[model samples]
Target: MWYNIDFYIWAVNLLVIRLRKPKMIAFVKSLVTPIVNIHYDFLQKKAIDEFILNHNGQVCYLRKALNDVFDNELRRIRIGSGNQYNRQYIYTRAEQKPVYLGKIYIRDKSAFADTGIDYIVYVPKKILASRELELIKWIEIFNEAGTAYKIIGE
Candidate 1:
């Protein structure tokens, strides 16, 4: 009787092991491993391509040049508001006052014009001259605008 009981227990364990799905384990491992390299690379490339398409490829070149100057400042700035409607940023100036900037709309009247888009940059009156100058320098370096300008609104 003891021998029969031991055999039954062993058979139950073997059955449970056999019933486990190998494909489920494989599916989970597949989701985790490629996430590091493959998914990240694809996302980075997609972002670059999208930026190029929206800004006529100027955003790519501008990003490199702007990084040299205002990369630190840019890091400090925060996107202020807007959902699917507009993109906005709020930056605290060197004097510790906040400025809000954003893109509004775009329209073209010329027949040959590319109705790309238009944008807006807003600066609060409380911002200091030094911070304003730094922001303007970045805008000039990037061939962008200050207080008001037009670009593709993404």
Candidate 2:
């Protein structure tokens, strides 16, 4: 009788596993891979405009060569988990994958709040709805705001 009961339980477990959907795994795989084809000329123009406006129309070292801004800052620094504050809005996603993933941290200003200076702008295995929109917003912020970033888990 005990052997029969054990077999019954095993059969039920197998059925459940087979019936389970694979949405979660699909989401993870998508996040793990990102599309890297795109143009940045428009963004470069926007970044330059933003810098000049923010700096009172002054062309400083970085402002003069704004195209280098993304290459210099975005590819540098370090990516954070965005878990320091346990904020739910920080998790990110890509609409059609991304060129990269990482966090953005302020280059200057010592002792700034961790959350304020570092934003988990991009990552794989994103959660929460509307994360796609959030990712786009944060990437723009990281690129245009003069913040530096680096990949952590990648």
Candidate 3:
């Protein structure tokens, strides 16, 4: 009889342990989740920092990023004729003036030299009114070093 009771107690203990195992595992996972998230956030931040450092002052990258920023918007603005009905903006390349470099004069001066803005971005006045701040922030983030640009409402 005692042996039977001991066996029942052992079996019950084993059952309880088996049931508790999953709870223990879940508790451990809960504790680990925040740490994993912190590590992942740190790694993501580090990657962005590295990219900014390595991206340097490349105009091509800045231009491409700017184009992508507009394209990625939910409303899908485009670069084309700034028709009042169209959701679009126009980008004009820097106008360079002739500077004597060698046999031929190099066009180095921007057409509008009075302003520090190197590129002129014209947006539909209505769209610009609504999105000016947002567009300006994205432009600043992706601007090339020693280069500046202005966004005008057309």
Residues 1-154, candidate 2: write the lDDT tens digits: 2312333234334544655356644544344333211114445676767764554312233222322333344443234433343322333466455535366554433223464444343233322132445434434443535554332222
Per-model TM-score, in order, reads 0.23, 0.16, 0.46
Which residue pairs of candidate 1 clash?
Answer: none
Candidate 2 residue 18 Cα shift, in angstroms, is 70
Question: Over the stretch 17-106, how does candidate 1's per-residue lDDT look in tens digits?
Answer: 655466654554455565445656766887756644444224445544434334435432222211124333355577565564445354
Ranking the candidates on lDDT from highest down gives 3, 1, 2
lDDT against the true structure, each candidate: 0.42, 0.39, 0.53
Model 2, global lDDT: 0.39
Query: Each prediction's Cα RMSD?
Result: 20.8, 25.9, 16.0
Model 3: per-residue lDDT, tens digit, 1-154?
2312333234335554556566665665566666666766777887777655555334555544555545445433333321222122233456354443344333333323454546656556766787788778766776657876656666
> Which candidate, 1 or 2, has the higher lDDT?
1
Candidate 2 all-Cα RMSD: 25.9
